[model samples]
Target: MSMQTPKQLGGISFGLMDPETYRDMSATKVITADTYDDDGYPIDMGLMDPRLGVIDPGLECKTCGQHSGSCNGHFGHIELAAPVIHVGFTKLIRRLLRSTCRECGRLALTEYEREEFRERLQRAKDLGEDPNDVLKSAVRQARKASNCPHCGEQQADIKHEKPTTYYEVQDVLSGEYSEQIAAAMQPDEDDPDDEGTSPSELASQSGIPLDRINEIVAGEFRPRTEDRKALESALDIDLTEEDMNKLMASDIRDWFEDIPDDDLGVLGIDGEISRPEWMVMTVLPVPPVTAVRRSPSITAA
Candidate 1:
């Protein structure tokens, strides 16, 4: 009978749901197995996650211009099974995305699924079931996959920024493009004909321009952003500044991205892919009290 403020729901003192609990308690429903596709196939792929309310209908959202983030739905439906997930409390249907098509349109969650999931979630709560497992399942299923709908460029939603010297640089260079970029930045012209090499490969090999191959093949490396135009001419390959920026924008800086799931080496970059620095820093009596780097592996190691 007493009203509790939304602000008082959680802080340092009490860890609880938002003060809008009564509002959220409205009936939420889960997508039943009966849900079907245009072909009469189960839209859920038979692997139903209770947490996921609906699958994303992979289509372009005309309103938002991009299909990745929240938007007021307004778009022509593409004949696609757009799987989506609905958050219980808010009944927010987040689209489950893969690689988005920049040329076509963005992803969108179905409103129908949102309402359905909310009802099911309310019922689950009333039954005194824990919401933790459902929440976790939802997280894994709902991976963030977004891109620029206009330029057809990949979205830089998740950034992998790193700072370091030797090993770290080498690690970053382990990616397919990273190695190509490193090789391109400093080309070896005197090494005779690079049989399968292309202007693009050359662009990646020396981190310079394919057009500037001759010049860069004999010159020092420059900053990634600046001096690209000059370098392009040196390579004599007609490489553009936009090309360099696209490569730079990619997750080429992440070595772990390319690393395979094994305890051993990846393609020849030998070593147990863990923190070698831990033993390096901790073992020495007067350990180097330098700035510590926090990578996913470092902390886990």
Candidate 2:
């Protein structure tokens, strides 16, 4: 029994449940929806497993060996057939997803900017100054960049549907960049500005480099290798040209599955936050046996 009133009681904090926490609290492995047998007895190993505790008076709880009202209801869990996004953290998820690059899965902030922000944060810590405002401002600035500096991929505007679903404005490769590549591939001799002079023809004709022209001609687009390598290490994948090609065709949902643990921690996830794609309802804690016991239905005379 708690001494504090409902208003004074500190509520439980909801967070991702690690396996250890889940298993320690669970009283029985619930497999079926049926709670009781034909005789109205709690079916063993069912949703109302006796191991969860005796819900009736005069019957001792199998777990705590206490009768109803004396024993608190034990915890039992339901393994979801599929994961659903946690409703509470929807905003956090949306912000983090938008702020991170889809291609490299890194924060939008460039390396130099990241270092500068980190140094400021460190200085603040050393000086015993509250860094909340500084950190917020830094994160805000980082999230404003429309393009990922590392991958050179323009970020799409994220639109979140009420409750759970999220969508983004995806760009077709053939739309904007294709025109630029086409412009780059146009011959210098063909350009009206080029006089076919004795001077530096290449420099005068087009400011774009020869290698860049070759890339356009070859129809080869390489993502920033530096960030790709870092992402590969985080995802534990080789990410060869072939892999990247395959990924280019896949949906963004697939990409979310490989986000690293460190990134999740930065997003305020504490422990073992694997695969941001689905929010797993891993553990379900049952109330005390006393809490589960229901009063008899009163019939009108």
Candidate 3:
């Protein structure tokens, strides 16, 4: 009972078994005027409610509260045809709608309509408009404008954002920060590394450095996000799972291990390891452990 699909546009709405109707109608798809949205949902036909110039089918009337109306002002005319049953087959009936006119809203129905209107709609449909055009026009009407129709604020400045779905969020985020995001999605604090040790294994096997690990993990002394990006670019590393594991296992001090203080140029921190060789550290993730409990015996009272 969606209020806005082509079924609505074709002046065909309410409830019907679509699969059964498709079989009965000998139709393969429930196509409307426009077949897709930006993300590819079939546009609803209610977009360009067509009208038949004859007896008001009452189905297309704008009178919302009377005669079991859907209250949509679309679908001016509908052509109702008999359920075409072939031979010895019985099937459920579902209504299918197609827009006969893109303007002055009209439709062909299989349920309620007089023959005169059907003939008129047939002539009009034969004379011109395609269902696809009507659907596309409707989608255009439903599209969001740059400014809020009510308040007139621009989309960028608006506070009430149209909540984005996971799909849209991914589309937008991937398009904008594909590189940075790629860098960020390294092996989550799990999985093994080159040395055959997971972050948790490294933590347990080398516990003495836990404090330093915490410092980096908690963002206390590690390089700022910007600095990390700069280093990533300098190393020409992807900062992916392998790269992250390598970085996490090795201390920053190891970067300048045997290079003399005079050769601090190797790090290019303006000839000085600004972070100090001693304080530079490696981080290992801690493992999560679950408490195992023995089942208690229930003694008879």
Q: Which candidate tops TM-score? A: 2
Model 3: lDDT to the true structure: 0.27
Best-matching candidate per lDDT: 2
Assess each prediction's global lDDT (C-alpha) against the native.
0.30, 0.57, 0.27
In model 2, which runs have C-alpha deviations exceeding 4 angstroms?
A: 1-15, 119-135, 145-154, 173-283, 286-289, 292-301
- Tens digit of per-residue lDDT, candidate 2, span 1-301: 5797556656766555554566678887677767667766677766566677766546666677777666666877666565546677677667766777877777778777766776777677799998766566665866788888777887765667777667766533332332443443344776778543221333234444556534533457442445334323433434342111111112444555555555444443443544455443444555443454452211111
Residues 97-126, candidate 3: write the lDDT tens digits: 011111211222112222333344445468
How far is 149's C-alpha from truth in model 2 (Å)?
4.9
Worst 10 residues of 3 by lDDT: 89-98
lDDT of 1 by residue, 110-140 (tens): 2343344445455657899865454433323
**Which sections of candidate 3 miss by over 4 Å?**
1-128, 140-301
Once fitted onto the true fold, the runs of candidate 1 whose alpha carbons sit more than 4 angstroms away are 1-113, 147-196, 200-301
Candidates 1 and 3, the one with greater lDDT: 1
Query: Model 3 Cα displacement at 64 (Å)?
Result: 36
Better of 1 and 2 by TM-score: 2
